[model samples]
Target: MKGKLKKTVVLVGMMGAGKTAVGNALARLLEVPFLDSDDEIERAANMTVAEIFARDGEPFFRARESEVLSRLLAGSPCILSTGGGAFLAPDNRVVIEEKGVAVWLKADLDLLWQRVRHKTTRPLLRTADPKATLAGLFDARQPVYALAGITVESKPDYSIEDMARKVMAALSGRHDVMEME
Candidate 1:
């Protein structure tokens, strides 16, 4: 059964944190729509995220990301998955705080690396030393991501369904965001 979703659930975390995968599962479990900010941006721009970052630079991409996020958050409640850096900006955080419930899919650096190491789609990880870059990013972003409304720890052993269920459980306590039937 679909429960009442009073606010949009925004999934935020590092690359390969399973935001898209887990958000899809969460949306299915909630019987709500699943939206990804990066996908939305890509569709509108008619370019992949990597291409956008490479061609237009991160600043331009971030502007588009914020625009998409604002538009989506203005719509009906759903499960929204954001890019790795979406929640880092203060402006984006303010809008998300006002319009949706930010949920950080917290995972250890090792787990994150294990998931992203094989993925070339991540533009940020295209550096010479991606592992070190990822570690630095993880260290810097942890404090910012901690500002989310909820935190769901993601372990290496957890499947998409498990993470989705964990996220659902975490949101269950927030009557403003979710209400179990």
Candidate 2:
């Protein structure tokens, strides 16, 4: 259980991959605090994530994400859910790997599409062909997601609580492979 070993568990994955939900449930199970990078950035900038992307662009948002990551990591033993692109940054990946345990919440292409289908607020997904865009994004991010210390495969029917329990069990060494049923 890198969470127990490292004193923190950081969730990293693609958008709509359940980082926030799983982080919250994992935090509750572990009796720790949960922090979401998007929420933190919103608080810091006084704007929604979509607004930040629209008004300031992604570079600005990435900068804000880095700042929040720094602050969150400084406060050890917290359960943190990072933005989809956050871990793609080399420094961010290094920080999460060194300072905390990174758990990648992965879902199949169809499942991911289903989870995010209703969202028009996702700046990246606001395209003529969102499904194709999502597929491309998933392909591009798979390797980055794989670098996490643990991988949790998300099911459409499973609640965050179910995933959290599996994560807890995995971290506790009761399960191997870090893949949730």
Worst 10 residues of 1 by lDDT: 1-10
- Write down the worst ten-residue block by lDDT for model 2: 172-181
Candidate 1, residues 87-173: lDDT per residue as tens digits? 999999999999999999999999998999999899998999999999999999999999999999999999999999999988889
Clashes per model (N, Cα, C within 3 A)? 0, 1
Model 1: residue 59 alpha-carbon error in angstroms:
0.4
Clashing residue pairs in candidate 2 (N, C-alpha, C atoms within 3 angstroms): 1-171
> Taking the tens digit of each residue's C-alpha lDDT, what string does model 2 give over 88-116?
99889888777777888888899989889
The TM-score of candidate 1 is: 0.98
- Among the numbered candidates, top lDDT falls to 1
lDDT of 2 at 36: 91
Which stretches of model 1 miss by more than 4 angstroms? none
Please tell me which predicted candidate would have the highest TM-score against the true structure.
1
Per-residue error for 155 in candidate 2, Å, reads: 1.9
